[model samples]
Target chain A: MTTRRTRLSPEERRTQLLDLGAHLFATRSVEEISIDVLAEEAGVSRGLLYHYFGNKSDFREAVIRHAVEDLVAQTAPPAEGEPVERLLASLGVYVDYVLANLTLYRSLVRAAAGGTDEVLALYEEGRAALTDRIFREDAQGEILVDTPRTRLVVRGWSAMTEEMVLSWAEDPAGMTREELLGVLALSLPALVELTP
Target chain B: MTTRRTRLSPEERRTQLLDLGAHLFATRSVEEISIDVLAEEAGVSRGLLYHYFGNKSDFREAVIRHAVEDLVAQTAPPAEGEPVERLLASLGVYVDYVLANLTLYRSLVRAAAGGTDEVLALYEEGRAALTDRIFREDAQGEILVDTPRTRLVVRGWSAMTEEMVLSWAEDPAGMTREELLGVLALSLPALVELTP
Candidate 1:
């Protein structure tokens, strides 16, 4: 039997490839996902895969960038709620995303730890976006001076929250999800207040 | 030319090898340091190197373990000061050690991020020792409950302090050492109080 090929626009084809790649990466490590296998799995030619992403490293970076973008979009706070309520809502969304995509999240953490420059850049972009969102919400009506010190505190608190979520993911019985969110939310104002 | 070999106790010889390994690691990446070169540089035979450490990975792990132990010992709090003063003094010593061993510290961070299990074990040992010291000091007079939540807060605070020092090491001018220490010190009590 002959296989019928479906024609698609370039943008649609790229998105398809990215989706397939992300699916594969979510379960297996980047090192284990070969380009040939990805191409075969996507029903595309190896040359087309390279044409879309240049190389395996580039492809992995693109996948990670897409994931980070998704995280930022998914965790963005609603504009109508009180600052504290919005903060909790945002963190709740963040935790849900992490729990839903734990394998992807673990890969992202591993990449941030020792991945390439492109991966690190994408990680920093995601972190900066999150920090900016928190800062905007956390400082809504407070008479706080915005300085490097304040930014440092915000960044530190962000890192702390990430660590807490990561540890919780490793041991779900460590604390209730609500308790984790509560601890993180309370620490934000305390961190801001303690910043010199 | 015949080289003279000095007779020493097993413990003395182990210390000698560890020192030489640490010295070499201080300037070069772990991948670049090989057993042959280490043996040649240390005036020991390759067989003896293997005798002491089963293999290159074992040798590297031993070196890292030695460094962590040194850090724990060097940063141990004095017995005669107030709890706060002792905490500050310990942190100061820890910071000074990192500053003095910046390359080693970076390697330790990299190892913690993506190195082998042995390296990560060594890193965790060091972190646990430091966290235990802080927890013991911070709990000197308080009747706080010892829960997973409290442990999570202490661990999170430890990570924040590390990130602060790593960032400061990258750019010393970003904040005064005193300010960095102050931010970390102040956040400890706040984190403890905020812990649920």
Candidate 2:
């Protein structure tokens, strides 16, 4: 395996490796993709991949974590807006992000379905971040949910959105953001006391 | 390969094969299983496993259909009662059934996740059943939803249950039927609402 002559900045190298790993992971089954392929694709040596990531499992975890962090950073609710608008915007960002990186999202989901225990925990943690954001702010005093109930509602919403995006990714038609949010707008209130 | 000497009704044999298949399919990855193993475990030859089901893919579809049918039987909302209570009872039934036959449910999910095109179609068809039940009785009272929105919400609810049950199965300590129902209750009014 080719080795780098000089050490790159840790963050830059780690980010590059994660990007390369995520691409490999998304395009094929995790078991089918080897560390060698990942390292070679990134123009880094296998030794460097190992040195930075420890092993294949660790590498996969880092890739998933990086992808999740990107997902969260991109989809966070706006710092200020109409509660409904912010919530809807956040959903739009999330759905768009999934659409943009469909392969990586699928890989992450497949890993959760049948990957290592560590991978599954990471997936769950990824899910919890979405759950937290979905319930983070009140919809401009429209909904009045207690703390415990809010978590449950958030959980339900998080689960629902994950499933919906998966289905839509598998089969997309003319579904638009406005329509999706509109539907969610109607169904969510029925499911939770989001509005006063 | 040993063959049965005595003839049995096709329905009887089919049901038997499905029961055995459910067990086999639920416990292992679909890609990892073999028709030979299923036939051997069912006390028949490989030919018989194919004879009733047509092929391995068909057999898997049969297994999923059977599991879904069982869930439908157990969780179909009662015809009469407070809608909330009926819905809660139905949800409980689903949770209990999943708890009882997690292997079966897991296998069904796996099949849905990784199967032939035909099997995936059947999975989608089976999933629609839950949505059907959701709006079957009092649907007339609700305002008509745009087709895309309706489908999105339906598919959303369908996926949420699988994710929820899988998580609860992993850690049931914090998840309770009542808590889940409470979340649903909070959202029901908005979900099945009649537009003015």
Candidate 3:
């Protein structure tokens, strides 16, 4: 038993724990989940679990951090294409990421709703990055205004993306990905290169 | 006690209960709130509370519905105006509505995040309404988009509105009503007609 447990590397073990924790947190509330259950289910000893994560909140944070990192990595801006094509590629990345991580994504939202400052901060940071990206891309053209206008456009785009992801996650069959992306592509001029 | 109670009609009493309930749910998890506390705080007997709202779930739904209705009512669309101007005016209505119903709005989000199918359905319905409104006023020739393109713009604009509202609800200071609306007005051309 000990040898079987040790077979996996520490990083591998941590990844396993995060996967298990994300599932539990998504299925059950944070207040309802405990360390004992997590350890038992993951086939690791309680001490080992604690050693890896100090407590439930720590575990929750770790899981969230991992999920956010994965999401950021997946949604990284696309390169070497038309600016709008790159934008659409990023949206595609987001759609896939959200679909794969629906449970964890929803839990992140739950965490935000519950006033988890760390989660809220991470969400803000992600949004700020997206906001900054839009300004950077639209900087040269007179189409883009000051930082404040960029912020609003970013805000609108962010809201629209989340709403779409949530819906698509819930009902994948109802809306085809192609249909959705086509609409988004056509709408680009309105959202991106708005004439003054 | 009877005289005091009689002064406030049944509708008034129900509204009072909802207001108190919204406050409790917003600050804490939905599971944490108790009907007893809600009844006492609302200055009504537990029996009377039950009479109006049969159980915890029912009461929770009632509170959410009440909040949704108030939000919708506060932002009634303008009677007549130019399409883009009308859209912006309606957006202003939404921002004002969110500001006025801040607490209840937060509570609605919390209750919606409960992961219950009923709550999820309510959230979807509300979201769809917002989408419908955006799509409805999407200027055809003015924006110059085919069906596919129109859909994307609609989704993008809708998404932005939701994001701004959520952020403003969480922290009004980060972005003010004027700042948000102004930025939105600038970005409006991206999805609407720039010229009057």
Which candidate comes out best when scored by TM-score?
Answer: 1
lDDT of 3 by residue, A60-121 (tens): 66766776766776776665666667777877888887777676676676656554677677
What would you estimate as the lDDT of candidate 3?
0.65
Clashing pairs in 3: A156-B160, A159-B159, A160-B159, A183-B152, A190-B190
What digit string (tens of lDDT, one per residue) describes model 1 on residues B1-196?
7698879999998988887888776787665566787888777799988999898888888888888898899999888777767777888898999899988887777766666667777888889888777667656555234567777887788878887787677765457888778778777777778665
Predicted structure 1: clash tally: 0
Task: List per-prediction Cα lDDT, in the order shown.
Answer: 0.78, 0.67, 0.65
TM-score of chain A of each: 0.86, 0.83, 0.76
Candidate 3 Cα misplacement greater than 4 A, ranges: A1-42, A78-82, A125-146, A169-179, A182-189, A192-196, B1-42, B45-47, B81-85, B114-117, B129-156, B166-196
Candidate 1 scores a C-alpha RMSD against the true structure in Å of 4.0
Q: Count clashes in each candidate, considering only residues at least 3 apart in sequence or on different chains.
A: 0, 14, 5
Fnat of all models, as shown: 0.52, 0.33, 0.43
Candidate 1's chain A scores what TM-score? 0.86
- Candidate 1 per-residue C-alpha lDDT over A80-137 given as tens digits, one digit per residue, 9 for 90 to 100: 8777778888899999988888888877776677666677789999999887776676
Better of 2 and 3 by lDDT: 2
- Top-DockQ candidate index: 1
Model 2 - which docking category? acceptable
